[model samples]
Structures are given as C-alpha cells and as structure tokens.
Target: MDFLPPLPLLIAFCGASVLLAVTPGPAVFYIITRSLAQGRRAGLASVAGVALGNLGNALGAALGLAALFAISSIAFTVVKYAGAAYLIYLGIKALRRPAEVRDAALGTADTRRIFRDGFLVALLNPKTAIFFAAFLPQFMSAHGSVVGQSLLLGATFVAIAALTDTIYATAAGTIAPRLRGNKRAGAAGRYVTASAFIGLGLFTALSGSSRAK
Candidate 1:
C-alpha cells in the first residue's frame, strides 16, 4: 500500500498534533500527580497509556465511527457526559486521598499499567475521535488508499503524542521531588490535580456539540 501522506498535509498534521500533545490536559494532570506522588516510572507508564489511547482514537476515526458520533447528538452526549464523569471521579478521588499514600494507589504500576491509563484516558474521549476524523482527512490525498493514508497519519500522530507526553512526564518527575519536599508545594500539587479534573469536566460538559463529519 502506498501509505505516504502528502508532504504539506503531513507537516500540518505533525504541527497540530504537537500543539495538542503539549497542551496540558487531563492526561498531563494525571501524569503529573502520579509522578509527584510516586516516581518517574509511574509517570512514564501513564504517558504510555495516553499514547495507546490516542492510537485507538485514530483507529476509530479511520474506521468512520468518529463520523457517526459527530452526527449523532445522542451518541455524542453520552460519550461527552461519560468522559466528564470519569474526569470528575478521578478528581474527587485524588482530592480525598491522603498525602502519605505512595504510587497513587496504582498497585506497583509498570510500563504496561502506565500505558493502559494513558490509553484509556485518551480512548474514552469522543472529542479525540472526532478530532482525528476531521483533522486527519484534511491532509489525506484523494488518490491514495484511504486506509493506508489514515494509518500513516495516525502513526505519525501517535509518535508525536508519545514524544510530547514523555516530555511532560519527565518534567513532572524532575519537579516532583522539589515540590514533595515542601509541604505547601505538595499540597498545591494535589489541589491543582483536583482542579484540573473538575475544570476539564466542566469544560467538556459545557462545550457545544460539533457537527463535524
């Protein structure tokens, strides 16, 4: 299969994906919390989860489910609310947990668990599916096999996402110690994680539905 995306489109996709990856979202917040409370390894694992989840989103877009979600208000609402609820739940859980707890109760999180968390977080967001569905096709060539083009674009997206998220994890891990040593800083980190979750949930709930297909 001729899998190459058009050069310009590829560049655009890479740029957009990088921007999205770098932006602090629920995934970033979770990774930061894990890193601060546990260690670098946990944070890296969460990053892996996010990468896999993003891949799933790309797959959904390639397979046309994202388009269906975009068109169906009911389906979109269900997904949006579900995602929002999950975020809120995570936030409340984080807030209620004692500071002395280590590893974020993730049970000796390895690379697999970290990646799983990231994957589930990204995969659960219908907006990500819609994003891939709308964004990837813009760069896709009409002449090539659609599936091939999509896979290439999706892979590129995943690679960028992984790189960016890894950076976030590393940074969080590095900063975590300094923050942990200071009681006020540690408290702030916990509060920020909780706020991020609730804020993201509220944002998702209030956002107008997109009809993009």
Candidate 2:
C-alpha cells in the first residue's frame, strides 16, 4: 500500500528514530529518575504511559493537523513555550522533593501515579505533537494515506523509544539501591535530577523545533 513508506525512506526513518531515542533527552531523564527512585517496574510502566501519549500526538498529527503546525510559526512558538514551562515546573518540583523514596519498589498507588505522570509529561509537551506533525510527513508520499502513514511512523518511533527507555531504566534501577542508602549521594541525586530537568526545559524554550534539512 502507498501508506507504507518506501524501503529506503523507512530505513532512514528507523535510523533516525534510533539515534533520537538513544540520545538522552527529557523523557530519558524522567525515566531514569523514576527507575532510580522507584525501581525497574515503575520505569517500564512509565515507558508504556509515555508511549501511549506519544501515539496520541501521532494520531493528532495524522488528522490533518500537521499542515496547521507547519504553516503557523505562532502555533509552533506557543506550544514550544508551553512545553518548556512544563519542563521547568517539573524541574522545580524535583528540586524541592525529598531525597529519600519510601522504598525502592513502589507500591501500587505510587506506581499508578508514576504512570499517570509519565503520560501527562509526554502529552503536555506541545513539542511532541509538533514533532510528529513535522517529522512523520517528510517520509510520506502524496499518494499515501496520511493517517495510515503517520500512525506507522509514529508507532515505530514509540517502539524504538520504549526499547531505549527500558534499557536506561534497567541500568539505573540496577544501581539505584546503592545511591538510595547513602545520604550524601541522595542529596547529590536531587540536584542532578533537578538540573537535568531544568536544562532540558531551557533548551526546549530556546530551541525551536526545526526538522533536519
């Protein structure tokens, strides 16, 4: 079907997605923190939630919203700013948070909270929606069904992201307990987490979403 991206385009897209996923970003930082504080299961659950949110953005982008995003600089700017603000807010919260977690493994209530927060983290970022709108269409052909093609590409991205994110979570979870005990390390961890979030936020605010040429 024309909805399927060409072999070459698909390959390129996959490669790009892998690179993007592997490169640590706000999402990665979020997953790492959750895993470090709450263990692997929480990290995985967060991954699922984030992926679902990303898929929602992809679906929205598929429904002819890409055109609006591409044509309107104002729209892009507003969303970008909003995302940055959210990230900064998250950073501030992280900074103010207690150094110690209740336990390495989260209880059901906390796990659900992590998952819900993960979903909102991705969903609230206008950058994600604009990113799907901007990035997926480049690989699509005029002859293809836009919705189908966008969904395919978006799913691919989500899958790749989930895999990479899990790897980070697992790795972080492995060492989380060590840091969990050391009070000094715990204090340091708080700053690191806060810095990561704030840095991502500032970067997002300054860097407008411009697709690769």
Candidate 3:
C-alpha cells in the first residue's frame, strides 16, 4: 500500500502546510486569546484541543474523499473542482474584507473547559474539513490507495499545524500583546494569506486538468 505521496508533492504539501499554519486565522486568534487572558497553560490546552479537532476534520475528509472516489471518478473530480472554487472564494472574501478578532473576555476556566472550548471551536468550523478535502487530493498519487494517501497527508498536515500552533501558544504573550492593535500588520498578513489561497486553488485546478489530459 503506497501511502506516501511523491517526494516533490510531499515537499510541496509541507511547504503549503507551513504557510497555512503561520497565517493568523480563527484558531490562532483563539489560542492567542486563551494565552493572553489565561496564560501559557491554558493556551497549551487550547492548542491540544484544536489539534485534535483538526485531526478529526482531516480524517473525515480522507474518508469522505475515498468514498467519493469509490462511488465514481466523475464524482470525485466534481468534488475536487468544487473544493478549488471554494478556496478561491475564501481568498476573494478575505481580500474584500479581512476578519477581525476582537478582544473578548474568556473568563478564567479550568484547563479542561478551555480545552473543550478550543475543540468545539475548531470542530464546528466546516471550512477546515473543506480545506482538507481541497488541499489533500492535490498531493495524492493516483496509483496509491486513496484512503492511505489521504490519511498520511492529512496526518502530516495536522502535525505541522500542531507544531506551529504550539509555538504560537508559547509566544503569544510576548508577541500578541500589541498585534491586535496593529491594523497594518494584520491586513498585510491577510493579503499574503489570501494570495496564497488563491494561488493554491489555481495550482490545484491547473495541475488536475493537466493530469486529466
């Protein structure tokens, strides 16, 4: 069972994962808030919860994609194109107006409750699952087992994200204090992330079409 993607695609996936991880999104903001208000311990708990939720999303995406592939190749291709369009839409929406994370009082809760909150936050966001569905297939090798490849790629991505999230959790107190107020920096980050998302969508669509031909 060939589980690993080709070396080049694996490297590309890793690079993309890093870029996505560094982008300040809902998870980042949630972790930062937990760290800022509750401390590193709380932040770490939050990170753990978010990582688990993301893992769930990845696994779900893998299974769902595999099922689609089993049902019909046409169905799978349709899903891939839909996912790409969704990514582009996300990028365009971000460009039009980046999301702002407002300061909210997350009252001091036990680490367990914070963990639960973080888990729920990530789990409930359907976008993450859609993202995994969109992004993982681009790196998959058609010759390999779809489920196996998807699982490996999904786990790899989740691991990278977890490592980056942990770093953010550890450093949030020092770095994030003034970050919320820096509109310029926030907007710049959003623009960069938006461009990356659009580029990824285009790359996926083009590569898929070329492969089809």
Candidate 4:
C-alpha cells in the first residue's frame, strides 16, 4: 500500500514493536493472568480484545484525541488516574475471586468477561493513546497520507502485539493446568496475578504521563 512506510523504516518499526511487545507490561500481565487462570484460549481472547481496543486508540489518536492530551494537563491527568483506578479495581476483583478459581481450564476465568475487561483496560488508558501518538510517528514519512499512515502503523503494532502476546499466553497456559490442580498453588497464582495488577496501577499512578512532550 502507498500508506506503508519504506522497507528500512518497516524493519525498524518491526524491531521496535517486537521489543516492546515482549517486554512485560500491564497488557502482558493481564494476558498472562488470563492464561494461567483460564488457559490459552482465554488468554488469546484477551489478546484479541486488547488489540481491538488498541485499534480504537490508534483511531482516536489519528482523530486528534491525543492532541487534547498534549494541550490540556487536566484532561491527561483525569484519564491517567482513571485508568490506574480501573487497573487496581480489576486487581481487587481477581484477589477476591480465589474461591471461584478451580483446576479446570476455564476455572473462573470467564473468557467473555475477560474479553470485555481487556478491551476496557486498553481503551481507558489515555497513556496508551498517548504512547501510540508518540511511538508511531517515528517511522512515518511526510509523503504519505498522515491519517492513513497512522492507521497502518497502528494496525502493524496490533499485529505484532497479537503474535507476542499469544506466545506469552500459550507458555503460561502450559503451566496453568499443573498449578491449578494444586489448591495452594492456584490460590497463590491468583494472588500473584492480583499483585501484578495492583502494582501496575500503583506504578502508573506514581509514574504519571509517559507522553513524549
């Protein structure tokens, strides 16, 4: 497509996306938690939901939602704190749901709900919108349609994320069955996941606005 970046830029983008995708972050934590709790299928579903939500952010960024963040500190702060609160809320839910969790593949994973939550988790994060705004432009060329370029690059990012996220999910799923069978281990596992979520929230809260000014 004419919207696509040049070969050298594509390679650079791919490499950077891959590196970021592999890095354990909030999205990765959510996917991994789902995998260990529900199995690979749920984890993959979560990935799909997250990807869709990210696509939305990419769209929003293209439409100038990100511009608002740059211009208004209040707007950015409100969304940032809100996202952090949501993460902490989800973490609390996981912590409280230990009784529902079982050894089975699904356990209490609730793939459908997980999907929705994953979508919201990604969608609500102003930081993600900001990240894409900052991250995608590095490879863009002035010659292409700016909006088309943004969407193309955003889709590319989602594709890379889906691949790497699935890898994390599958690997976690393999160990899930064994861990879930053991009552103590399963409980412990959920707590760990819960802790990761809460930690991410706290980190996001404290770290604030990673947007490249």
Best by TM-score: 4
* Per-residue alpha-carbon lDDT of candidate 3 for residues 1-213, written as tens digits (9 for 90 to 100): 598879999999999889888887657766765675445777889898888877887787787833445456676566556656655664675477514322221233378866886676565444566677777899899998888998888889878888988898889645544545556765665566467557655654555322110
Off by over 4 Å in 1: 23-26, 102-114, 209-213
Cα lDDT tens digits, model 4, 9-118, are 98999999988888888788888887887787788888888888888888989878999988998988887788789889978987877364445546555777878988
List the candidate numbers ranked by lDDT, top first: 4, 2, 1, 3
lDDT of 4 at 94: 74
lDDT value for model 2:
0.75
Candidates 2 and 3 compared: the better one by TM-score is 2
lDDT of 2 by residue, 23-99 (tens): 88778887888777666777887787788777777777778655676788887677667767877886798777653
Span of 10 residues, lowest total lDDT, candidate 1? 101-110
lDDT of 1 by residue, 1-213 (tens): 467877887888888877877777656776776676556787888777777777877888888878888789888788878878777876787688776653233334456655665566677778878877777888888988888888789878778877877787788778665654566766777778778777867777777654211
> What order do candidates take by TM-score, descending?
4, 1, 2, 3
Candidate 3 lowest-lDDT run of ten: 98-107
Query: Each model's TM-score?
Result: 0.83, 0.81, 0.62, 0.89
